[model samples]
Target: MRPLQIGILNVMHDKAATNARFTKVLTHAGRPVALHFYYPKTHYPSGAPAEVAAILAPLDLAAAERMDGFVITGAPIEQLAFADVTYIAEVQALMAALAGRAVPQLYLCWGGMAALDYFYGIEKHLLPHKLFGVYRERRLAPAPLLAGLPDEFYAAHARYAEMDRGQIEADARLHLEATTASGELLLVDRPEANQTFMFAHLEYGREGLLHEYQREVTAHPERQYLRPAHYFTDPQTMSGPQFRWEETQHVFFDRWVDRVWAKREAKEVSA
Candidate 1:
């Protein structure tokens, strides 16, 4: 049997470790995964612009025929119009490239915003209040990507912008997969196109949140974005919120590969 092919478009250098963990999860789930890194940070001493350029360059239509699934990582920059960001145009082009593709694709945070904007054609509103913390998001409907998830799940978040629930309801191209108690649309799943968009980070473990808090403190202390209460667990020990009814990290790749594998099997049968 051919190993499952997985491509990861990582935009942030800070998220390289998180993406690495995702690779490990896919490997542990018995799928051969290849991560294609796209780092846009110019400050890193060893960072390469050529690698970023390669991902942004153009997708080989033939290459897309081989990968089973793809995942796009989020960036820290947020704006009403995605075009305002330096690499926004390139990223949007990538999203557009993946449009109409049969393969399953999942996006996180800013990537979620990008997918929604590309597919639904709605811009994110500047949030009055910065949403920073661990919050409970209730799953709206059953989705193949979220097949095993309970109705209510916990996810980590750190953002200053959001999409209006009313607008999401009005948009026919998207479906509201989950919402918070205050009625904010948290998860939007597109079952037909084999696409999933999560506003919050499920792949982030307890330690990831802690590391983010520390990074925020060290890097942007003036912004004072670090909040202790929003974490899934405590900072020191990195355990105990038990919000999702599970201590383990959400292995999204496992679920993703399962869906893709089923699709491949069905395609083989049809052939």
Candidate 2:
């Protein structure tokens, strides 16, 4: 089969690091992939202008149906209303351009919130406090996507809001596929709607959280950012954060990539 063609609609201010983090995880997944970067021209108040950067690639809508899958990475504007997001108009247009295509889209973090809103009309509600930590969710069903994940596994989370579970469960097109023991929903998707939403950052490497913490602390020391939970090799002293989630990251990406590959082949078989 041809290398899986994945599209990244990146709106992160620090594009280089986000790109590298995703590359590392995907490369480690051991799947042959052809990545296409589409930088939207919309702006984020807290992020760098979605302006033209040498690294940003113009989106090729004509190639939508050819892609094995697409990914919409998270942004930092979760607190804003969807329509208020600077690029929502452009993103909506891009989604329209790809209408009728069945490419699987994986939405991460704020991107997940956006997808939940755009595709399923599901809204996100603010948490009492930012849900910033390493959280573990148990798989809720048997599906190809959950094929090799541990019964319960950890991943990094950095978000200020979560999907409205009542809306998600009541929507016929969506399904809540994973959740924490406390019953907080962690994963949801509308298979018929061709969308999957995940609130955590599965692509984060060992220091992703550390760097995030460092940056937040430097910018807003008054926020008194707590060190993420269950993330350190030694909390009392010494050493860096433990590399607890690397293997789990690998399994999740591997399964996801393989799922995309299977979709590509299945289409070919039917044709």
Q: Evaluated with lDDT, which candidate comes out highest?
A: 2
What are the lDDT figures for the candidates, one per model? 0.64, 0.74
Off by more than 4 A, model 1? 39-65, 230-252
**Tens digit per residue, CA lDDT, model 1, 1-271:** 7766666667654654766666665565675555554443432336555644544423343455456777777667764467676666656655655665576778878888878877777668878766766777676666555566655566667666786667778888678867776666567877678778877766665565566667877887788564545554554664564345132234454676677778778877997
Candidate 2 displacement at residue 111 in angstroms:
1.1
The TM-score, computed over Cα atoms with residue i paired to residue i, of candidate 2 is 0.89
State the weakest 10-residue window (summed lDDT) of model 2: 43-52
